[model samples]
Target: MMAALRRRDFLFGSSLLLASPFFMRAARAASPRIISLDYGLAQTLIEFGTPPVGLIDTPGWYDWVMEPPLPPGIANVGSNYEINMEMLQLLQPDLIISTPYLEWIRPQLETIAPVKSFPIHAVGSSPYPHIIAATLELGQIVGQPQQAQALIDRTERDLLAAKAATRRLAEQKLAIMTFMDARNIRVYGPGGIFQDVLDRLELQNAWTRRTNEWGFSDAGLADLIGIGDSRIFYMDPVPADVLAGLAGSPLWQAMPFVQKGHAQRMASVLMFGALPSVSRFARLLAEVKV
Candidate 1:
């Protein structure tokens, strides 16, 4: 009886060993080589534990609100608008992820590989939902469903916590804008990432004026004063000279909010006012002194 039992155990172990290679091959076949064109998509890939082989805007990895540097082995594919076609052809990625706004570049990129676009900034598309959907969609394309779900769950929890922390200050009226060099300024109006952040905090957007189709409006110093009396949160790092210029401008200095010291400077996180993820947005809010 003992001999028979030993033989059966040996056969079971051998069977698993024989099947192991097939399972390993199936697992290896699951993960696809992906090229990400958007910074948000690149961040999603990292969250999913399957970073892209090549990415546009590698510097964004460090400068981004999340501040996680890209791994050394990853290749830079140039700017989002100007991808290196030669390098992309050489890499031959299985999938290319981009934002819907870059649809104009689709024809050129599709020649290389399958391309997927997420309409992150589309009308009525909220940042949190868009990021979650994009991450899950990319996971399906790259065979990382479990990782994608985990990231979404984590993001949701973090956002909820941040909201709870700031619940008491929900009544604050906030305005987010950026100085464009010395002469022009861009302000986020309704239906923008900054607006979304303000909405989450239950704060009001001072600027009720309609922005361009992309949710940003250009204004001169004189026009900015007309926006509202809400405490202004200037996005992006302004140079000392620009700050001095604003300080000297009668139009800027005379603004009630500015004169009352209700204006503050913020680091440029969401360039163009698109929050990539909850993690990024939460970090932006966490760093806000006021």
Candidate 2:
């Protein structure tokens, strides 16, 4: 009887050892395979060194939100308009990170996994606070609260360094815009993420015109002329056609800032981004002397 009992226990122990890998994978799957549908959140997660299992529009994300690069093998679920729900389901994710922009598809996504919606540019609330709060919240959710705080602290340090470097030019009124074409421009104004960064650095915004809740005004060259010699900084990745058209346009040449040689071009920076992006913009501004 004693010999039989010993053999049974040994067999049970061997079985457990053989089954451990599968059990471990199941536990890991239970620990939330987060899928970020938003670029800002993806960037945030990457900055924290926790790349999501899935995200939307990986190619566009690479183009627009360049920094804090995504890790290899991240699954691209689909576009913002239509998520590849079939692919998402195949991943068997435990969580789906999203924002209000995906409200239309939230219900469907929730059906796959517990959807965690973060209002990035929520109504009536500034994005700065939301960015920090969201970062912390995400850290807690992902079991990396320390990393999130460290990233925020590091970003703050970098911003302060950039601010000190640009102290002499802090008071310079600046106009930052991105061109959709030769005629149309989206100018960043008050209540925008850029404005919040400028405010933190004690910089003044040149475009005082009222903007939409998203904190930008879509207007023509006529609207931009009012900027009146403030250092004009345009974000890059300008369409080749737009650049060519602007080169020959009489009105563009006649603009006061253009005539005064105040216009300058900076590399692509995401207008709606998180902490790392804001830090990047600050560094870019400091590096590019107006």
Best by the lDDT measure: 2
What tens digits encode model 2's per-residue C-alpha lDDT throughout 235-288? 878888988887798888888889988889888777778887898898998897
Best by TM-score: 2
Displacement of the residue 108 alpha carbon in candidate 1, Å = 2.4
lDDT of 1 by residue, 13-89 (tens): 22332343322332344455778887777777776778889988776665443434566788888886688999888
Q: Report backbone clashes per prediction.
A: 0, 0
Q: Rate the local accuracy (lDDT) of all candidates.
A: 0.67, 0.78
TM-score: model 1 vs. ground truth: 0.80
Task: Show pairs that collide, candidate 2.
Answer: none
